[model samples]
Target: MKILWIDDEIDLLKPFIYLLQQEGYEVETATSGEDGVELARREVFDLIFLDEIMPGVDGLEVLRKIKNENSQQIVVMVTKSEEEDLMKKAYGSWVDDYITKPFSFNQLLSVLNRTLKRRSIISEQMAEEYATQFRTFSEPADYLEWVDYYKSIVSWDLRLLDYGSNDLKVLQKEKKHEANAGFAKYIENNYRDFLNGKGPTLSNNLFAYAVLPVLKEGPVHFVLFDSMRLDQYYKLSNSLREFFEINTEFYYSILPTATPYSRNSLFSGLLPLEILQKFPQYWSFEEKGQNRFEKELFAELLKKHNLRIKYSYYKLSSIQDIERSINSIVNDKADIVITVINFFDLLLHSIPGRGDMKGVLDDERVLLNLLGYWFPLSPIFEIFKRLSKKQRRIILTTDHGFIRVRKPTIIYGGRSISPNLRYKYGPALRVDNKTALLLNNPGDISLPYEDPSVRFAIAKEDYYFIYPTKPTEYEKEFKFTFQHGGISMEEMILPYAIMNPR
Candidate 1:
């Protein structure tokens, strides 16, 4: 570890430097705050020791400059003056540690040792905890449900990564990627089984199994937000307690996690093929524009069931539409209101197209932070707050989750192939059989067949389908980008929650 010490009386600190050296730390000295700031700008240090009283560019100023340059660097403030106000001011400026003028060399060494040692201990603990759980998680038979197991493991890994243990975080991330790869294989083996009713409840049956049972108590507003990840839902659930008591559940999203398929299937309580066959005009597979009109299909489903006890369907893809939905909640006649908020999907799509958004969400941690910041103030919450004052219930859910795609598998097909990163549908579609969930017969999975020769293939884990044309260019552009509509735990396992106002 390297330590940068900035004090006007640097010569007096030689004994302390000798102690730190004995403790196996490299020490660098700067006589003035100005020099210290300049050195900080040029080089990276594990920690900085800055004097509180310096001639040119005082210690407080230097601390501010250092923090502004690199907020993560640990800074300790050393001051000769024992004024309480000075200590308070120094703390306010975000100093990691404070030392008085008459402090012993042992005390200084103790502070440095303790700070660095705490980080080391945390790293070790994280590694040990993950290692212990890793063994149990890796057992083949432990995972009865692929989606739930994959989510549990990813959630643990994500939490470990947030603990900021550098070495352990790297290990956990690799484990997560490995788990995702295995999950992809599991999906390849079992997705068809699930879709064919040989496995568990899937996207089309999510509402029937999860939401309908909860609705027996009272009105349930099944709000299916588009592109909501499990982690994002977990974060948002914390803030919901103030207004409602929430019961959480999870279900698998069908292939093509996009709005037109997964979401439409979700609201209509039917698969894409069923919807297309039942109401052909309402289903538009080739349309690329926003599917705002798809909410009507949900209304149609309710009507078909003869359970028309008053309901409304709203799709909010913009701020204006969100406001409209919020205002619509004032009408208390509707027993259930299904609102599909598309902000996360919009944000995901915008990241690659907008430079500022790309910069902000470049890192997964930053992306999670952005979701946390946006969720509490979202229009959905505004609508929830309004509805909480009424005699009703809210059921929050999503069509699918998203995964940050890293590996691209090259797939070849005819020109008729639908160009979706997570899945493809066409005749003669070629992909690694092990890497995809091949539906050679679409009818078995309740999916539409475009032609007699047509078939659909969904990417089973973190792998996204990349066309052979301009392979390198497309791979470079799409790698590490968030995508969905396939079979990973994140993309398939969705939140189905029942909440009543507190």
Candidate 2:
């Protein structure tokens, strides 16, 4: 590594420089701030060590000039002074790190190793760890084990994202596919039982089980961001830690992992067929605006629990809506506030190759990188920030997650079939039994339909359903785009978090 050290007493640091050079570093010395600034401008460096106190054009000023020129430069401030104000000033000016004078050679070496070799070291360690774990891999036996297993995969995926080899990523992908197949089988076997009251927490009873107990604590603000995956939630959780203490758990989404099904079940505390039977006015066959009666359903849910309290509900479709209504959402004095943010759902279903999304939407990692870049500036982040200050108890979750479909499964269905790419429902639907779950009766799985003959075909793994006619055309439009309404680990297992202001 190439390093530049700036100190007024350059002769005094000769011993330190010799030690660094002996450790395979190329070192250059500057005796004054003027010379240091000039050298920094003319030459590129892996790291620059600047003295915090100097006689002429002190270290802080030189640090500012260097940062102004190239903000990405790594500069470590070294000083004999122990004042907090000076250290803060150096850091405020964007110093990469700080060190006090009379430090040992090992301390200097430790800093250099951290600044230059951290990524590579971490990457190597993670690769070894994963390789070790790969030998002992086994299929999860149940949903609870599956939750832990899926979480492990997601954790590795995120870490490998920043520091993993291509081979490791491919291996992880294969393992995820295997897990999805197992999860699909598990669901096929136990889903009906789950709905029959043998499964863990699900969408229909989430509000009753998770939210109602928290209600007695204090006022609650429940925010549901549509189509949020576990990986995306991990990214958001890192940012939320600054203002709140977050406790997150996993929950299962009901069959047909789509908004009209899962989200409606979430609010109404009833399965799709139950909703149709009990509240026909709120249930509909149409996909669009199916969630329009969420408030009414929520009211009904409240009544069922025998709890009557004022609650405000808001469904925001865009950033503009969040910007315009966030104040009201934060200021409302209701016993509970529910806000459904639709940006992530819209992001998943929107067409690709649009504006900045020219090449991002097709790749999950790139899409997540885009989200990481946008989250801090997003109005949704602003809502969280504002809500954190109010000390309100907050519950956060999503209707369902999505998976990027890579394989296409051909199926035959009438024109009345639902338009979702991951699943199809209508009369006499025909799909390969190996690639999907062909439910002969929709009502058997608690899906809603007036006719008893209507059936459902839900795709498994990374498959998307395409019609027999013009299959290529359909594949071209849907391939690699994220989709829901199917049985996959990403779709069924979801993140449920409770945040309290710190």
Candidate 3:
């Protein structure tokens, strides 16, 4: 490992340098910040040790310049003074490690071992450990243990953060798919029982079970991002730590992880059959701009419970809309706010299948990185950032998650059917053993249908339903794009998180 030590008192660090060299590290020493900057620009360094008190150029300025050159350069600040402001500045500049003046030589060695081995020498052991643990992840005792399976997958994903796209991580993705196959079967068997409160939380009961009762305590801000996966939430959770203490849990999405079902169920606190029976005018099949009655559904739920409070609901589609409405709506006196942000779902649909998306959003990790980057820069992020100052209780979650569809399965259906690519519903739907579930009658699973002959078929694993008429054309369009409304871990398992002000 190549390490650079920049200190005005270069003679004082000779013992530390000798120890590091004996430990098989190449050490380069600089007597001044100017010399250090020149050396850093000239050569690559695995790590940099910076002195807080310097003569000509101070430590903060050197830290700024080094970060300006390479933002990801690992820096450690060694300081004698215990000024809170100075330590904060060092930390804000992305210092990887910090040490006090009187810290033991062994302490410095411990820091070095932790920081350096994360990049090298630990991959073999981590891979072997994951290989053994993969067997445990593959088996689940029941439907509840499926949540544990999802947690295990998230654990593996977290461990692979510093090391992206390694072979072990790749194998973990396959194992995740394997685990999802098991979860799909589990949901097929006991989804209805769970909906009746048998096991893990489901999408239909989120409002009644999780949100409304919590609202009895204080005002809450609920933000829903459509079509965001559980793994994607983990990617974005690290960023939330700066503003709030996040508490996350897993829940299963209702079948047909699509918006009209899962999102509507969330707002109404009832299944589709119940919604159709209660408010017949609310149900509409508008695909692109569906769930138009969510505001009404929220109102109905509040009124059903005979509770009254100030609240606001928004379904924001554009960044401009978010910017325009956020200021006015947040300023209003309200006990609760529900905002449905549509950027993540839209990006998934519009990006993939375009010829230029080969390197941009070709897989799960790349697409997730793109989406996670957008979350912090989003106007909603800025709004929540302002809310954080007020110590508002913010609930961050999604209506449903999405799965990347790989294999194409043929489905023979009627002239007009449900437009979801992952599943199809119509009268006399002809589909066989490749189904996640075959609902012979829609009412049995709480699905709404005017005709009793109408049945539903959801795709299993990574399959997307392709029509017999245009097999090749449909394959060209949506062979590997992210989709929901089906059965899979990424689609059904959800991240339900709450952020309390820190």
Candidate 4:
């Protein structure tokens, strides 16, 4: 790593610099703080050693300038002074570490080891831990163990993304896929029973399990960003950390993991079949513009819970709709505000169909950059910024997440089959059984279907179903684009967070 040291007593520090260089650090020296400040601005250094009480520009001032250039840059204050005021000033300037003068090589080495090399050390340890623990989660875990396994992998993925090497990241990703493969099997075995309240909190149980408890604290703004995955939430959480203390967990979206099913289940607090039976007016399964009935369903949920609460529900799709909604939000007030933002979901669909944005659909880094660019323009971001100032409890979640489809499983189905890339249903549906779940009866899993002859084929892992009629066209369109509505960990698992003002 690159190192820069600034001190007026350069002669005395020659031994230390020579030692660092011998130990494989590229060390540079500046005799004055002014020179050091300019050098830091001109070049990139992994670590900086700034002398306190230096001539011209002073150490504290130089430290401030360096921090202004790059807040995350690691800078250690090396000084003879133990004075409280000077040390406080150094700390205030974002000094990453400290070392006193009249110290030996061991002391300096200790500081360097802890401060400069910390990320690499931590990354190595974490990668080793994951390697060691891989086998425990490699086998099929039961429901609770599966969640715990997913949690471990998610945590490791987030950390490894920050510090691990490319090779380690690949290993972690492979382990993740292994876990997902096992999870798909687990879901196929129990998903039908799970929809009947056999397991933990589900999409249908969200309002009762998550919403009411959050509402008891204060006013709430619930944002459901459709097709948002866990990796996406890491960036979002960082952006929001400055405004809110975040509490995070997740719930499993019922299959098929699509907006029409999972989102409806979330708002209605009932499975699709139950929603249809209990409130026919609010049930508009897979119909165009069906999300328009969400407010009515939400109202029905409040009444069913005997909640005497006021709420404002909005399903924002167009820019004009968002403008109006923002205006209404700024002017009016409600106890609960629910907004379903669909840009990510739209992005996922548009990518495979439209070539302009296709390059980002399969690359995680590019996709994250696109998201970073889009967040500033997003109405949900504005809502978060506005609500941060108010005493509001904010919730950011999604109906379902998505996965990039790599393997295309060929199938044959009638024209009545659902057009979702990850799933299809019809009497003629046929495919290799091991690639996905082929349900002969929709009602067996509590899913809604009009015809008795219709069956379901939901893709698992990275597979997407393709019809034999349009092989070339389907292959060209959706080879690596993100899609949901299947039983992979990405689609089934979702992020649920409660944000309190910081």
In the range 1-502, model 1's lDDT, one tens digit per residue, is 8999999999988998998899888999999987887676555577889988889789998887666444446788988887889988988877888778788988888888787776667567767877787767643432245556666665665555334567777776787677777766766667667776776667777767876676666776767777888877766675566578888877777777777778778777888889879987777767574365566776776676677567677666787777765777546466666666786855454344466677555676656555544555566677777777884688888888888887888888899888788888889888887677777787777787768688888886678888888999999999888888787668876777888888
lDDT (Cα, tens digit) per residue for candidate 2, span 56-165: 79889889866754455689999888899988898899888888888999999888878767547656787889989878988877779889988999988887764677
List TM-score per model, in order: 0.73, 0.80, 0.79, 0.76
lDDT of 4 by residue, 275-368 (tens): 8888777666455865667778888888889999889877777656777788676434788888887768544433435674656755665576
Q: Which clashing pairs does model 3 show?
A: none
Residue 21, model 1, lDDT? 91
- What are the lDDT scores of the predictions, listed in order? 0.74, 0.85, 0.78, 0.79
Give the distance in Å from residue 34's predicted Cα in candidate 4 to where it truly belongs. Answer: 23
Model 3 poorest 10 in a row by lDDT: 345-354
Candidate 3 lDDT, 1-502, residue by residue in tens = 8999999998978998998899899999999998887676555688999998899998888887666444456788889978889788888887777788977779999888787765565567777787787655447877667777787787677667534347877787788778777777877888778767787777777876778777998999888988887767776665566688988876778888888999998888888889999998999755665598999988888887788898899888877888898886566558998888895745554443666476544755556555544556567778877888888888889988887788888888788787788888888787766454778987878888878788899888888888899799998899878788888878888888888988
lDDT of 2 at 44: 62
Scored by TM-score, the top model is: 2
Segments of candidate 4 deviating more than 4 angstroms: 1-123, 135-140, 285-287, 318-320, 345-356, 373-379, 470-473
Q: Candidate 3 — which residues are off by over 4 angstroms?
A: 1-118, 286-289, 345-356
User: What would you estimate as the lDDT of candidate 1?
Assistant: 0.74
RMSD, candidate 2, Å? 8.0
